[model samples]
Target: MRSEPVPAPAGDRRSRATAELTWPGKRVGHHAGLVPVPSPARASWDVRGRLVCGERADSLLLRADAGVALAELLAAPGAVDGGVKLCYLDPPYNTGERFAHYDDRSDRAAWLSTLRDHLLLARELLAADGSLWLHLDDSEQHRARCVLDEVFGEEAFVATIIWQKRTSRDNRKAFSSMHDYIHVYAPAGPKVWKSVRNGLPDEGAFSNPDGDPRGPWRSVPMNVQAGHATAGQFYTVTTPTGVRHDPPPGRCWTYTAPRLAELVADGRVYWPRGGDGKPRLKRYQSEVTGLAPFTIWTADEVGDTGSAKRALLSEFPGLQAFDTPKPLGLLERIVSVATDPGDLVLDYYLGSGTTAVAAQRLGRRWIGVEQSARTVEEFTLPRLHAAWADAPGGGFAFGAF
Candidate 1:
C-alpha cells in the first residue's frame, strides 16, 4: 500500500534488512525495481532479517512486508523456525475501508486478490506440523475458506470455529450481525497443534453417586430407538424384586441382548423397580464421550467489547487502536487451544499486538510483524513494555534490543 519507495534516513537507521529479515523472493513493489523496505527492530536487531544475535526472550516485534514477507521467509526458512509455529492471519476484508498502514482499500474483487497473497505465504511459512487459523467476517469468510481448500487441500480442513464477535444484534440492518468465523486448517501429519481438554463443568446435572472414586457421575438413558422388529431387543426386563418391564412398543434397547446380558450380570445396569424395568446407563464426568474445546465462543466466554476496551486501557489508558480489537482473554483461549510454550506464533494483522503479548504472558515465544509502525509505536509498544515490566524472573530490556 506504500506507493512510493521509502527513502532511507541519512544516519545508521537506514540499514538494509537481512535476507532472513527480508524475503529474497522477487515481488513487484509499488515502485518499479524498488528494494524492499526494512523496518526498525528493537529486540533482535537486524537491518532487515539478518540476526545480530543480541538476545531473544519470550517475545519479538518483527517488522516485515506481508506482500513480500513470505518470499523473504521461504528464502531462509531455517532461520525462521525458532520463532514462528502457529500463524494467525486476518487480511483486509476488502470492504472498501482504509486500513491503518495499507491504504489501498478494495471492493469485492480486490479482497480475493489480497487473500491469495496471504494464503500463499502461510502455506510456505507455516510449520509442517503447525496449523493456520484465519480470521474473517461474513464479508469474506466463505471466500477465504474456498481459497484455503485450494491451498491446504480440502481434506486438511479442520473445524470452522464460530466466534461470537459481538453480543447484541446490531439492529441497524435487517439481519443483525453478531458472530464471526475462524477457519482452522492444519498440517496433515505429526501435528504440532496443542489443545487442553477443557475441564468438565463443576455444576451441571451431575452428582457424586456410588462413590465410584473417579469423580462425579450422571445418568444418560441407554435406550436407542431402532423402530420396530429390531433383533434381540424385544425381550423383557425384570427387577431383582420381580418387576417386569418391556421396551415402549416402537422403542428398542440401546444394546443387543448379548451385551445387555453382560451388563445385567456385571450389575452395571441401574434398574429402579428391578430387572423388569427400563434401564438407564451411568455416565461419569471422568468418562465424558470426548473432551472437546468450546467452538461456540460467546461474548461472555471470551470477553465482550466493553472488556476488550478495558484491556486496551490496561495497556493504553485512553487509546483504542481499531474499532473492535479482540480481548487478550480471547486470544489466550485461542493460544491455549492452538499452541504451547516455546512455540512460535505470528499475527499478520497485528492491530494492537494482543496475540504477541498474550503469548509472552502465557510463556510461548512470539514474533509479531505489523506493517504499521504507527500502530506498533502508538498501540503495541507501550503496553508490551508495561507487560515486560510485569514479566516473571528478570524483565525484558530494550537497551540490549
Candidate 2:
C-alpha cells in the first residue's frame, strides 16, 4: 500500500505540517500524543501521519484521527472501488459522557450531522455485496434508523440485531436498559449479501441409530402444508411395522409419489418400528450446513459487558481507559456473519480495537480508525500489538491523520 499522506484540505491546521508521518516496520511502541493545531478556516480539526504496512508485512491498517476525515486513506489508489466487505462502527452514543480524549456530548442536529457525514462516506467504501453494522443503544437508535434509511435507502435495510449487553437489572431505573441494537444495512441491496449461519453446539444430536453407512443423521418431518401441496404430493407411507400412515389434518407428504418411492428405494426414509410414529426423511449430518442466525443475541451466545471488561483487563493488566469495550466474541460473530477469510473489514470507531483483534484472529484483513490519541496509544494499539505477537502471525501499520 502507499505511504504518502492524503493531500490536506486547504487552510486546515495540518496544512502547515510539511512532512507526513509514516511508520513502516514490524511493530513499535506507542508514541507521544499528536499536538493539536488551530484551524483558522474551518471548525473541524486535523491530525497528520500515514501508516502503511507492506503487502507481505501485516494484515492491519490503523489510522488515528477523526474517521470522518480519512476516506481517502481507506480507499487507497488502484484499490478496488468498493472492496470493503464489512464496515462495523461503534461511534459515540451521544450520551453526554466525557472520555479522557474525546467528548460524546452533542446536540441532536450536530450528532446526526456527524453520523450522517461519516455514514455517507462509509457507504461509498462498501462493495456491492458489502454490509454495515452500526452499534448503538436506545439513546439515538430510532433517529439513527431514519438517518440510515436516508443514506442506504429503505430497500437496503437489513435486520436490527438486539444484543443483550448486560445480564443484571439496573434497579435505579424503572426498566433496565440491558440491551443494545446493531443496525445492519446493505448498501447495494440485501440480495447481494451472502447467507450467514451460526455453528451448532455439538454433533451429538446427529446419530446413526439406524446403522446406515451414511455415518450420522437426523430426522425431519415429511409433511407440507395442504395449502401449498399438489395432488401428487398426497400419498400414504407404510412403516416397517406394517402400519400405514397418511398425512395428518391439513398437511400432505413433502414429496411426490415418485420421489417418495425413490427415497424409499434408496433407504433414505426413516420408518419407525412403533405404529404410532410418523415416517420422517433422514437428514444426514454431512448434508446439513449450519443454523440460521436469529435477531436476538443473548449474552451467553455472545458476551456481556462484565465479560468484556474482564477481557480488556486481561489484555492490558493495569490500564483502565475504556468503560465499555465490546467483547471479542461479539465482533467475531459480526465478522463471521458478514465477511469471509481475507475479506476487508473496516471499523472507523476503533475504541479498544476489539474489531481489529477479532478480524485478525479470524484471518481477515482489517482497517481501524480512531480519533483519540490516548485510546490509540494506551488501549487500542497495545492490545492489538499484544494480540498479534501472541498469535501465530499478522502485522499492522499505525498512521495519524
Model 2 TM-score is 0.80
What is candidate 1's lDDT per residue for 102-155, written digit by digit as tens?
553665555665565566665666655566788888777877777666566655
TM-scores vs. true structure, each candidate? 0.70, 0.80
In model 1, the runs with Cα more than 4 Å from the true position are 1-55, 80-85, 99-104, 189-207, 224-290, 388-401
Name the lDDT value of residue 31 in candidate 1.
Answer: 26
lDDT of 1: 0.60
Q: Estimate the lDDT of model 2.
A: 0.71
